[model samples]
Target chain A: MNDSTQTAVQHRDYAGAKLGMWLFLFTEILLFGGLFLVYSVYRSMYPEDFHEAAAGLSVVLGTVNTVILLTSSLTMALAISALQRGNTRQSVLLQGATIVLGLVFLVNKYFEWSGHIHEGIFPNAPELLARSHGQVQFYGLYYVMTGLHGLHVVAGLALIGIMLSLTIRQRITREDNGKLENAGLYWHLVDLIWIYLFPLFYLIT
Target chain B: MNEQDNHIVTTKTFAAVWIALLMLTAITVSVAKMHLGAFSAFTAIAIASAKAGLVLWYFMHLKYEKRLLKFLLLVPILTLAVIIGLTFVDVWYR
Candidate 1:
């Protein structure tokens, strides 16, 4: 078949598109998985310092953020369902809620990080540097992992924003809701990573 | 498209999963406060894994996906397990 003919035939294969997204998500999983491996190795090596450092973190704040993310995931799922059911207005409202929830999570993160920084607890702060090597590693990993996760949250917001616009424009209809579904998948992956991160960083100690 | 392929998860199911996850979070946090030694870590991770499973299966629609897609999802996780296990060997010996 000619190239143009083949392209036309391959268009609108929702399963194929979803498969491509899943493959991309696998790469993302591996990316974070490598970091988790490093975390485990370090935790094993400096068990005491890791525990002590983790104890300084605010479990209340962590739990609150966890709830926020979980709620956002629910809204995201509902948004996709709304889109699939041809309820564009409701879908947009749910998407807005998800985005607002995501922002709230980020705001809480900001305050949390600032609190740590104010207390000289940042990765490279003089206070942190003066701490034991294990403490230093603990803070370093904490910042890096959570920072990366924050970036994912920002990216998810942008993607959802685009989906919102697409929905408004009727580009993403009930029959062509794959993009919205894919966006939900990405958002869930972000939430999924945090599920592991919350326990690893905050609770395990 | 097949009806099953386009299955829509109910809001009730999502709410139930959210409640279960929150309850698990509370349990893990309470478990953390008790000095359970190594078991504390195990319990926390186990709870987190359950929460993640619910999110993956329900929120991410992996349960509604085709069998092949579901298997494909496991490939990366299995690969990571092997990688982590090998790394542990080095850490254990040293």
Candidate 2:
């Protein structure tokens, strides 16, 4: 949200910016949509193996991370709300909280992945490969889906981090904060993906 | 964008939605513990869909956005649904 003249009243198309963000989110849904389609097909093809494989996952960790992501989405949304009300400092603080929550999610993911790896259950490991084909495919989708999701978390953190700085510098003021709003949209989309991931991967067992 | 562009959703509303989302999470987790047979997956997905709706409507401000955006969102959702529906039909019959 930069203006060339710093005093030319700063033209901004708020609706257009938000529309662009939503368009980006649609592509994201389809990107993961293809994966979800793959997941559902495999799941139907090998229901028993899928169920057994999913049971190996730690529901506790999954639930914890789900909570973390959901709360972070709230913070991200609230940060935008705070800015809309001209509460710049509060908005910045909420953005910081969102970043912290996002990092916490990744930390939980690290421990979860490490735990699986320690058990020789990672994708393509000899232990995983020796299993039924259905089980193999299950973990394959698991890693690919969650790994991709974790990357989005990292990108979202960087986006919010930038928005946080801009908000602090008053570059994203109450009147023109489309950048912050777009960042918030991206963060929420990440959370939305996790919502489906948690149940399909962790809870379905 | 006009003055109404500054639609400030109250913090209380946000807090309420947060509580609702958390409650739905808890419900989904608890539901998974039950032996609903094939319905287990279906139920869990239904609950998760509800949670997603809350995030989209409130957190993402889709509820407050223009009508065109609502239609824009319908595009991807419908496309995904059609893809999944056709694939399942083919798989189920074969």
Candidate 3:
């Protein structure tokens, strides 16, 4: 919303933050969308290879991460709401909870990627775990896409931390909480990306 | 906030969404396991697109966003979808 058009503009820092995040998310989707387009085209050309590669991924880990990220999203939404309701204590608490959950996702990713690496399943790692060259390429793209996404998660965590500090320092109030909402929005986009990535990368067909 | 305005989500809503997502996950995985002949590609991506829509609606809060913001967010996806369609039209058919 423009400056004059908003009634609570002065206190709605989160609104502009979310708008910027949505724009950034647009670029990110373009980046990942390009890779996905490549994957989709290749999946059409060589279906079995993609299926076999996807099958090797750990479903349990992916599901766990999904739940974790989803929980974080819930906590994040609640965090902003807490501030809105003028409950700073609950706001800080929920925000901290959200950060921890976000870390859990990264830690899970670390082990998950390392498992593939240990098995010599990475892109440049020549010998696959009894798979094809295309299969290797699939995992390679999976790593690239997810790994980059993991980095974003970390960056998002940093942003969350900043927002958390603001909350503690009394910079963030219910009236001026657009920053928190924007951070939450970006975080949700990350979760949204993973929801698809989970099925796409871990569930083979 | 009125009692109605304080409409915290009920447990049922969360449970329902989770169940749907898990069911969708199971369906996608099982469908992948089955060799659906030539339709496999179409079916898998179709399922994924549906799941993506679900996530966009609930998790991304598109349903709660400003109408203009919603339109702005969609512009990119629509653009990308068109570009993807054009690429397939030119490359896949020929």
Ordered by TM-score, highest first, the candidates read 2, 1, 3
Candidate 1 residues lying further than 4 Å off, grouped into runs, are: A1-10, B1-4
Clashing pairs in 2: none
The sequence of per-residue lDDT tens digits that candidate 3 reaches over residues B1-94 is 1112223333455456656766776677678668776676567677767766766666566676678777897788898898888888876899
- Comparing to the true complex, what docking class would candidate 3 get? acceptable
Q: Where's the lowest-lDDT run of ten residues in candidate 3 chain B?
A: B1-10
Q: Give the TM-score of candidate 3.
A: 0.83
Model 1 preserves the real interface contacts to a fraction of: 0.70
By DockQ, the best candidate is 2
Give the interface-residue alpha carbon RMSD of model 3: 4.7
Report how large a share of the reference interface contacts model 3 reproduces. Answer: 0.32
lDDT of 1 by residue, A155-196 (tens): 999999999899889988887788999999999999999999
- Angstrom error at residue B25, model 1: 1.1
Model with the higher DockQ, candidate 1 or 2: 2
Tens digits of lDDT, candidate 1, B1-94:
4323799888888889889989998999998999798888889889999999999999999988889998998899999999999999988996
Q: What docking grade applies to model 1?
A: medium
Predicted chain A of candidate 2: TM-score: 0.95
**Per-residue C-alpha lDDT of model 2 across residues A49-149, encoded as one tens digit per residue:** 99999999999999999999999998998998898888998999999999999999999999999998999998779999999999999999999999999
Report the C-alpha displacement of residue A63, candidate 1, in angstroms. Answer: 0.3
lDDT of model 2, residue A38: 99
